[model samples]
Target: MVERMKTYKAIKYTLFVCCYLFWVASAVLIAVGVYAKIAKEGDVVDSLTADPALLLISTGSLMFIITFFGCFGALRNGVPLLKLFLGILVAILLMQIAAAVLGFLFSDLVLERTEQLMAKGIARYREDLDLENLIDFVQKKFQCCGVHTYKDWSGNVYFKCSETNPSLEGCGVPFSCCIQWKNESVLNTMCGYETQTLEERIAKDSIHTTGCLDKIVRWGKRNLILVGGMTVGLLGLEIFMICLAAAQISRIRGKVKTVNSRRRAR
Candidate 1:
């Protein structure tokens, strides 16, 4: 019985820690949500200009941070406040999962739509258009859209843009093919093209953050899948902790009552 009580105590404290973690995850998710909200405000992510990689990265990072805490919520802590916090964390994690699913599923849809629009844009920009310049334009636009490789920044990769501007112009035109991060800049792959005119356009295409999500997306679905898988696992742990916490509370109450009754009888 003592052993059993010890186990229960262990589980109870575990729950508390888990709940605390979930509270943390909830806090991260909330922070990410706030950042994304600010970044994506107004026009939001539209069909024509959305950046899949950026979306995935920003959202995934948020999930990753929050889910870290979420996993702890699965322990056996017997605190109502912690439970409440766990619930919030779980809910936020769920929303993030939903967002990821939406981002993943609709990604191809947006891709198809945007590609079609690019084709149209290409067709429309003909006549006075520069075919050479168009290649430059396409390359630049794609690079700006978070659609390139990591080594591409090192100027070593065989990117689509490289074929067009084989000369020094294409080799060093970082802004010619990269996204601009607001209030944040990096020395490596980023192009600092701060456009006030693109404020609306920026609001439409990219997930808002002081960081870049492009790094993950250019490689395909792996990052998002990893993040989603992590979120699901963390969420499961949180649920377990919450349930355990509840059980511990009941047991603790029962033990308290028994001890008090015996003392009164004595």
Candidate 2:
């Protein structure tokens, strides 16, 4: 009985520590969401542009609430809070499974929606400075431009590549479309000037002619193994914590039952 009590204490404290760490992680996620919100303060588009920050905020808040129960319940040996935490954790796991199945079933629709969102961002590229920077960053990182090809820039009013367009940016791509050069110290803001009007062969020498979607798809394919590993790792950890909480709850209830029976017999 003494050794069993020691084992329960060890499990309880271990749960406390894990819950504390998870809580901190959720707090950091919330901070990142707030930072993203501030970074894109003036732009409020609800599509892909704003979804990331909102997702972070919502997920972090939910995790905070759930982990609070786990942390306090473990520390105080409170069965009610522990049960609540376990119930919510199970619900979350089920929801994740459902989402995965739904995503697979609606794969084509998801792809179409993604393209539409990207197109919207491209079309409104000049409306928000933060969004422009984000698009530029993605283009530079992936070494690709526009949605499916550099030619997709034609969808943007400012880069329509038409002589009739009055915008100074017409017939040009953003500097991010330029081929990055090693040892270049300064950015040439006009590196992509008139690129849309140039012949494909000629443009190939100075700018990325491919589209971002293909590059992004390729990137995901390449990192599939890594992403899968991380997802499994996180899911396993969550399951482990849930089990630990359940075990502790069982131990506490058994002790309570023993105490009540002893009192009745006395």
Best by lDDT: 2
- Which residue pairs show backbone clashes in model 2? 148-211, 149-211
TM per candidate: 0.38, 0.86
lDDT for each residue of candidate 2 in 1-266, tens digit (9 for 90 to 100): 89989989998999999999989999999998778777875655555443566667888998899999999999999999999999999888888879778878998887788788788888878766656777899999999989888888888899988879998888889999999789888988888888887888999899999889889888988999997898789789889999999999999998999999999999
lDDT of 1 by residue, 1-266 (tens): 79978977776677656545545665665565455445542433333223332444466565555444434433433345445545665676578679778867898786666555444333322122222244335454444422332222223221223545453423232243444456655533433222212343452343221211243345346566776677779777756755665666566667788899999999
Worst lDDT run of 10 residues, candidate 1, spans: 123-132
Candidate 2 RMSD to the real structure:
2.6
In model 1, which runs have C-alpha deviations exceeding 4 angstroms?
20-225, 260-266
